[model samples]
Target: MAALSLALTALLAGAPGAGADEPADAAARGPRLYVPDPNPDALRQVVDLVKAGQYRDAAGVAAMVATPQAVWFGDQTPAQVEKLTRDVVKDADRSDATPVFALYNIPGRDCSNYSAGGAANTAEYRAWIDAVARGIGSRDAMVVLEPDALALLPADCGQDDAEGTRTAARYVEVNYAVDTLEPLRGTRVYLDTGHPGWHAVSSIVPRLIKGGVGRASGFYTNASNYQTDDANSWYGKLISSCIAYVEGGGDAADCPSQSVPRAEAQAWLDAHVHVPPSRMAHFVTDSSRNGQGPWTPPAGKYTDPQDWCNPPDRGLGARPTLRTGDPLQDARLWIKTPGESDGLCLRGTEGPEDPERGYLDPKAGDWFPQQALELVRYANPPVL
Candidate 1:
């Protein structure tokens, strides 16, 4: 409560409004995030570890879950989603913390891959977004809208009609969500760009503009993927600057990308992107599993390595915070639930086991004890 009071004071000193444009320093120095109640499954894991005489590990798991992370909503009816959203926002309000919501129910989400599941079509999806907006009515909340929605479209997944109808609808769905949610008094919406490692600056900026980045607060990177803070932040800066440049009548094709040398990219920004930090699209990065950074499998290990799919020996990144001194950046968040399996990673082999790990990884979103312990043990800054 005392810390909460100090954070509120700091936010007051900055700008008024949650997710609204405040002074750069005030937003950077804003209050610590509202930590949600621990997941019941996570609590049970801690208890199980205690019974096993693994007190230190139990404490680590407990500490990890206690830290702030996103509250995800997906695959629910409009009524159910509204209530669920309301419940979370109210709970966070009691703690004087701004809740970060990951809205993941966009149509054709994950491209029918391991994590595939979403609304049936654009109409239903828009209704869901409206319900979410209602659920979050008048509460300060941040939305990392639809991970991979912009980065992986139906066209990219070969699910598009001949005219790319589904792909065009994908853009419509995302834009509807942004228009619906961003107008709420206290909601800030950030569209996804997959991760720094996946998309180049020029490629993703166009997707963002088409998907309604112009009307939204900003964008986020490295959701549910491991790219080091240095990498994620640099990638974020490039994309933000590139988007600003394109929005200012410059060509996205002319925008610098990660493929260019770092010195060259910085030089390009210096030459063209003249917008101040406040005018540019701000961003957040996922630090949930980047403490150990990304994993590198053996060379030519498999035809489809799926390196993003639960590669071993990863650890947690920095704790979630709003006071990240970088003005163009907003916060570093745990967008993915750490310790959850990415899915069964066969690594292109016809087997049930994850070849690299020598076991069948749990289904995506399932509690994974082995991975959970590994994360706590290897967590950067030490989980405990």
Candidate 2:
């Protein structure tokens, strides 16, 4: 645990910090993940804490914001997105860092859930992707394309038409993004699988392939959820192996589910799923807020216990980096900024106050000060 803390502290010191530098090889060329300006609200939190004479807490907030996290782009015009993307890549270039750009504007995104907003149709999405790609032309950047595009499809959440028209378009939009962005000289595009806990290996591999994981770098799991690093890694390995099997003409349905005991799953992979690391899909996992693992709501307390929502007591997970030990695991990223809320979590209740937390959680993407403190305090590998 102390070693892990040391590594996290190094990462906080700088991307690919001591003992975590990216290989010099061309395939893994990102020098370090870029650290952009901190979110304004986060900056405010630090200032407020200091003014209130909480110097130690203020430093903790400052430290948390200094770590690298992905910059999300969605709901922007083609002209706007292109400029924004160009500016970010240019900034990272100036800093000699490779920024991770998370694209989130897919049609019918998030199944109209809390983080609900997207392009109105496939054409707009395609255009937006093109602008982003153009902006990233020949620049060094990693693209976590469309967080829930493949994970929470329209059909999966019953938001599709009777003929699954919207769902079909969703696939087209995602495939278009993959096709458009993955071809860039410096961008590595990853598809989505929501998280390890949400989709079975069998269920998500097919979705990944259909969404064009084969053409891109690989897929990402646990985008904004609190699944542990071990669980996410195991899930990624299984998913990547399944994709390889299917690419080699094996059925995805034959892949082992995460529920299968680990020993058995490894045996299954050894016996059947064989593709060299370079030949197979490689994955990244979100370690933004998995430190304390997941929040376990008081059992049977709320009817709709939205466990994924802003559950208190969660902590920041592993620091973002380009070097993960596993060859097939490309990166462990802070895909979700640690101190932000996941929306007003009603948790199946009547009043505005969340019964679970006894307070109204901030709206999605808002800076959550209380949760921020909890994240730093309970952080398994402490954020401070």
Candidate 3:
């Protein structure tokens, strides 16, 4: 008990409202996004680069790999998940820092794409979520639940049952996760909202409502995508406003989208809603690779843009932090681990090699040495 108290003290010491006026047991006031275990492949790359006397390259890689970022939990059994979660929390407890977890095991996750694979069914998914909750047990952690779960539904991807069984199952699965995880005293749950580039405000607001956004801490954007921070903040604000409108007896269909002029959208919100920032939902963004603000394929180049796939020359964006000045924008995070691969992108080519780079790309979650070096070299704030 004494040790835990000391740990909590250390964790809260630098937090806002932790002065003499506040109670020692008060919850930390600001963003507390957790940084999980670093990817081993990234570490190995660092070592290899250093051994080859690539000192500048080694420093750049180290700048990214050494930072604290969210840990991902996906495609693991219940027992394996429980142990991993416990280990992360245990480490956070020792270090006096919060932990962030990306939970990605919804049934039919990723729309059967390159990162395809999830729990076999809703039952299996619930058991997996249950195990994750048990592992968390009341620890202070941020949970980014199920990337692409709502955005790339089974129906949207042509993977759904003709009778809508799979679509219905998807909603149930997300709501089940919200119901299960949100009740934990110290856990903050955020639903995935694709990104600014993909879903419009009018479209995703209803999905978030049906998927239990009200019960969650907030929704996250740009999870494993490369959209700029300005775009993401705009998208998130519009979504939060739309949610407020819907909660106050307005229709989501009436809300403006990213397509609308910024002034017009704000004017529409101003005319219709009176919700305060404190009352509305908050959001986080994955600024992992938005430094260059998304890749644009050469015009008339390919049938499919595949922009989200590993684009060449993308850079790291803002570093991870909870102290974002905007009240509605909670934090800018490295939700998509930098230096990780986004699958072998063919980019409308016939061969296995990527036409954009003239090389065979790494599979999802694998390390790409060339891309890793690019990220470090072009990091937005500069890795060095």
Candidate 1, pairs of clashing residues = none
Q: What would you estimate as the lDDT of candidate 1?
A: 0.85
Q: Per-residue lDDT of 274-373 in model 3, one digit per residue for the tens? A: 9999999999999888888899999999888699999999998877777677899877788888888899899878859988999998999888889889
Model 1 stretches with alpha carbons more than 4 Å out = 1-30
Our model 2 lands, by Cα RMSD against the true structure, at: 5.3
Write the residue-wise lDDT of candidate 2 on 58-177 in tens digits: 666667778778989998999999999999999989978888988989888788888898898888888998999989989988899888888778888888879989988888888888
Candidate 1 residue-wise lDDT, 159-266, digit = tens: 998999999999999999999999999899999998878888889999999999989999999999989999999999999998899888999999887778999999
- In candidate 2, the residue pairs with backbone N, CA or C atoms under 3 Å apart (3 or more residues apart, or in different chains) clash, namely 195-222, 343-364
Clashes of 2: 2
State the displacement of the C-alpha of residue 323, model 1, in Å, after optimal TM-score superposition.
Answer: 0.6
All models: lDDT?
0.85, 0.84, 0.83
- What is the Cα-based TM-score of model 2? 0.92
* Candidate 3 global TM-score: 0.91
Score every model by TM-score.
0.92, 0.92, 0.91
